[model samples]
Target: MEIVASVTNASKQYKTGDTVITALQPTTCEFKKNELTLIIGPSGSGKTTLLSLLGCVIFPTRGEVTICNQRIDGLKQKELANVRLKNIGFVFQSFNLLAPLNALENVMQPLLLLGISSKEAKQRAEEALRKVNMENRMLNLPKMLSGGQQQRVAIARALVTNPSLMLCDEPTAALDIKSVAVVMEELKVLSTTGKSVAVVTHDLRLKQFADRIIYVNNGVASENPTEEELFH
Candidate 1:
């Protein structure tokens, strides 16, 4: 499988006055195309930090982050933003759709930001919504949609970019069982279509959909965590 994104000896830290807090320890991991990888851990674990690193939302204090084989850790903010817009897609637990925008408009926002023409953005957004089974709700505003529907719209927005890596942070956290199943299945299918999908989630039931599992605890990451390490 092709490596869409990777972190080598990457770590994150925050300095609060005189104290330094480590959010993530040095860790190396690769997300590959055609795979669904789950980063699982309890609250306060470093999973979210790791996801942020992969998403290029934050720079690693030390070490490197590579997306589509380009090193990003040393890039300027504008350059990093451009890289993210081109190579990465992000799905947040909150859906993050603009309340005033209808489904299609929200999905069209990313492309519009890239200076794509309205006609082309609309065409691509429609196709993306169709992929997530949200075509019927194209004109509905976020307030009018159910949580699941809004999430589907968000997924469509992410997919509209045709990014190589999709970083989802607790995507299923706010969903009910049926909705969770629908969303996870959609993501799993997406992975098989040459996109690398990495999900940071706390739902153990989601393990069934994972092609690879990474466990994080106390700022440490383990590719093959023991049963005790996962549960206790």
Candidate 2:
């Protein structure tokens, strides 16, 4: 498989007045094209830290990060923002949809922000909603929908950007079993489109759908873990 993004000897550290904390250990890893990869670990084990670095949201303190073979760790803030807008889509755990907007409106916001016309944004947003089986809920407000429904809308919003990489953080943490299954299956389908899908999840129930499992612990990254290591 082709590598969509990679970190080479990358690590992150935070410095206080007199103390330094290592959020992630030096490690090299690749996120492959058209694959569903899970980064699993206990809380505070640097799973999200690695995601942020790979997504170009935060630069690594040491080493290099590349997406599609372009080095990004040394990029300026403006350049980084451009890269993220063009290549990365984020799905937050909180389902951060605006309460005032209906489902279609929520999904179109990002496209509009990217300077797409209202008509075109609406068209693309509608198609994205259809992908997640959410077209019927396009007119419903967040308060009127179930948690699963809201998450589907969030997924539609992420897809509207046509991003090469989807960085999902705790996507199923608050979802019920039924909802988790629906969302995971939907996510699995997305991986067939030649995009890179990386999920940071604590839910072991979703591991069966992953093509690769990356275990993060105490700022370390272990790739291709056995099923036993992932679930137990």
Candidate 3:
């Protein structure tokens, strides 16, 4: 499979007066295209930080990040923003939809910002909703939907852009088993459609769907042991 993202000796540190906290230690990893990988770790283990760096939301204090063969770490803010807008799709744990907009409108926001005509954006948005099997809820506002329904809309929004990579942070954390299964199924289908999908999750129930698993501890990551390791 093609490599979608590569990180080498990446680290992030924050200063607090005389003290400095290293949020992420030197780490190297790569995510492959059309794979669903899980980054599993406890809180404050740099899971979200790693996702931020991968998505170009925040630059690493040291080392390099290459996405799709491009050296993204050294790019200017404007260039990074453009890269993210075009190549990265984000699904937050808290379904970040606009309360004022209905499901369809929320899904169209990205296409709209990309300069697509409103009519075209709406048509594509409907198609995305259909992909998530949420076409019937397209006219409903976020307030009118359940947690799983809202997340389905968020997934549709992320997929509508046809991004090269999708970053999901604790997507199943706030959900029950039924909702988690629903969301994971949608994510699996989304990954099958050719996008590299990476999720930072603590739910072991979702591990079976991952092509690869990275277990993070104390701000560092390592390849997780197989299911045999859990029972042995």
* Model 2 lDDT, residue 140, Cα: 98
**Models sorted by TM-score, best on top:** 1, 2, 3
For model 3, residues 81-113, the per-residue Cα lDDT tens digits are 988888899999999999999999999999999
lDDT of 1 by residue, 1-232 (tens): 7999999999999899999999999999999999999999999989999999999999999989999999997799999999999999999999999999999999999999999999999999999999999999999999999888899999999989999999999999999899999999899999999999999998889999999999998899889778787778
lDDT of 1 at 41: 94
Which pairs clash inside model 1?
A: none
List TM-scores for all candidates, in order. Answer: 0.98, 0.96, 0.95
lDDT of each: 0.94, 0.91, 0.89
| TM-score between model 3 and native | 0.95
Descending-lDDT candidate ranking: 1, 2, 3
Candidate 3 positional error at 65, Å: 0.5
Best lDDT among the predictions, by candidate number: 1
Candidate 2 steric clashes: 0
Of 2 and 3, which scores higher on lDDT?
2
**Winning model by TM-score:** 1
Tens digits of per-residue lDDT for model 2 on 45-97?
89999999988988899999998778996678998988888888888889999
Runs of candidate 3 with Cα error greater than 4 angstroms are 226-232
Candidate 2 pairs with clashing backbones: none
What is candidate 2's local distance difference test score?
Answer: 0.91
